[model samples]
Target: MSTPLKRPYRRRNVAKLLARLHPKGITEPFAGGRSTAPERETALDIAGALGAAGQAGPAQRLAIHVLCLRWWPGLFEGPSRVVGYRSVAPTAPPPSMSRSMRCVAPCTPKPALARVPVERPAETAAFRALADLIGSRLAIRIERDRAAQDADLIRHLAAWVHGDARPNTSAAKGVADECLHDDLAARVLAPTFLASWARAVIAEYRNPNHCPSCHGYGERLQLTAVAGSRARVDVASCDHCIGQGVMPWSKKRRAQQLVIGEHPFRQYLNAYHEGALALLRELEHRGAILLLRHLGSDLAMDTE
Candidate 1:
């Protein structure tokens, strides 16, 4: 019989196959049997894990890309499959889970207040400071875009207000009113300065009202997360207000005055609404962030 052909070297075989398989050769090093390049690893890991978990979706993939790219430069460096993340198969519930899990209630968060009431002195003071800080930050951020003479002034004010050089806590105490409103208007050219001015004007002029829905007690309409499904929501009436839209109050005459609804307060309401819209615009432009942006809750302004 003819002698058997000499077997190829194991290393040579691997090298040849790898060369053909990866014409560019191994550009990135391997880590724990996987490629070290984050883009490659993430593409594989996300596809595998999400596919296995059965939650993969176009939006999820895009979200993952957005999330990963914040820290992982490799992910957004070059074009890759993740760029077409939408093309992945539509996600569906995993086949392995029991039916009970599928029918489980969606998860949700419980609402804190049963009813919302008029703003208190302490709360209003906090709000004013926060609004000022936001307006100042926006003013500074916008100053870079235009060559306004007030740009430097805006930058200085923003830095002092937002940075560690802010007004002393002792000085800020009892100085919470719109005392600085004129200062902001005079020194800052940013759009939020107008918003701050409007807020100050509203605070000065608006007649405070207890929330019609929550009553002045600041409690109305309880909200609780669904038992299991976090995404679902459940709402109930405030036990204190009893859903009647009124709460116990000793100042019956003042409450009646509020119910009578004076016109000046109405003007304040309109102005504050405009101010809110302006603040929202500032957020849209990425100049500032509202508390709701961080907590994902509206507890701060439950009065409306």
Candidate 2:
């Protein structure tokens, strides 16, 4: 009798056997096993756990997506392409034209960390809208003149929550100034009075010595052009005084002021700087929270 024929082992059967033996090891074999599905599922789980589901709308979804992007940016990667090939062959010319050029195939380009084209525009719009909404809710006027600064504040807030750098101090100070000015205006503080008050406070703390170049005037006039009968003059702030009209007070002078200071006097002088900083910190902290809330609501409305 002829010998029985034996079946050959195949990769498919081996893979299936492994998958059965260790179900968790292979998610899906021979089906482009690497996928973003797990990443998406994890994102959804995070969102749900963070109270982002249920009544959450498009704005909320968008905000969640933004957070997801920050965490797992690879999930949003676009279809990759091979831009160009590189030569792996020797630098010397081939012996014959018929010889094949030994070239290495190009790798699929990775998405740039800073470039998320599809969602960036929408993300920007969301931030701006959040800024505006937060401003409105907080009773802070988003003036057209300072719109750019306000937008920057919103961007900073977004960066902060996403584990990036904090907001710029100058930007925060600017916003604080605007808020203070608005509050004073609402109380019907006269502009001239406000200016005089600021000048008085500054003068009290400033060194008694005036800037010699400007002689107590912040600006100095310079002859710009000479015509036949008339001369053009331009006024510029004195570089030495930096437009303050007085020299900066020394540490010794500050100590002397403290020695003469009563409790009220100390508080008054400290308020000039400390009060503004405190206001800025509060605004930034509260604004960040409100912005995220508004972003979710807006995103939900958009989806509907």
Candidate 3:
């Protein structure tokens, strides 16, 4: 069979969007990259335009699908804090489209995370929703998938609850606490809904590389120009920052994180200490000494 025809560079809007969203140079996808919102929104808008123009092709379909965020951003957006994007192969390419290149996100301008938290409208809204869900008769069930996330979420949630439920309270707790709470509902969600806040915490603590630039995986996307036959999308890695996630330092920016005592993570952990101690005490109260051996080893090994 003959290969599919490639769009000419003059009309390669999808190609441009793909490149903008793809990693460039030698870095990775990051959440706060300057072009992230613009590129993503443009892709969706252009894809819609293509569909309206009656463009029928696999390339258009794949492009549109990639840009379409899940309908319920509020649901998964929370837990995704601890859990990064699931590793799914890029949506299968159309038979007509041949792979050409891959690049990280460095080509796009990145904002400095010097002393403030970036405003993520979608995530902020979700946290607000969670605050409301916590105390009312309303219920929203979400899963906590990983062990590390479980611990992290608990810490952030503890800070969130105690911070009086204000929006963008990262300065106080290193977590966004923008929720309207019901005391009973909060007690119900402490263990389960905590994962979503992990992302908020990460946004605050990310090092320079993972700072306002990365797509959270330490890389970005780059698109190769549409050439003779096919254009390619590449994923690139950040050479500046070695970490895959959060960091405690940033040499490039000459900025240092707040000391442990003043930092949000420290406060968040402290907030959770109360819940932890209470749970341990309750376990001790029940005389479940055998179970306490492993779980209660931290506060003390008093398995009596």
Winning candidate number (lDDT): 2
TM-scores for the candidates: 0.17, 0.20, 0.20
Q: Please give the clash total of every predicted structure, in order.
A: 18, 5, 34
**What's the CA RMSD of model 3 in angstroms?**
25.1
Residue 153 error, candidate 1, Å: 26
User: Tens digits of per-residue lDDT for model 3 on 5-90?
Assistant: 23222122222333333325223232223432333244455334535422445433332322221111222243323322333333
* Candidate 1 lDDT for residue 103: 69
Candidate 1's residue-wise lDDT over 117-218, tens digit each? 333223234344444654554455434333342454455456568885764544333233312234433444545444554344333222233345644323
Model 3 ranges with Cα > 4 A deviation: 1-202, 205-240, 243-304
Per-model CA lDDT versus the true structure: 0.35, 0.40, 0.34
| Sequence-dependent TM-score of model 1 | 0.17
TM-score-superior candidate, 1 or 2:
2
Candidate 2 local lDDT, 74-153, one digit each (tens): 33445455554543434554344222333342343333333222322122444334333333322332244246656766
Q: Give the distance in Å from residue 287's predicted Cα in candidate 2 to where it truly belongs.
A: 30
Against the true structure, candidate 2 reaches a TM-score of 0.20
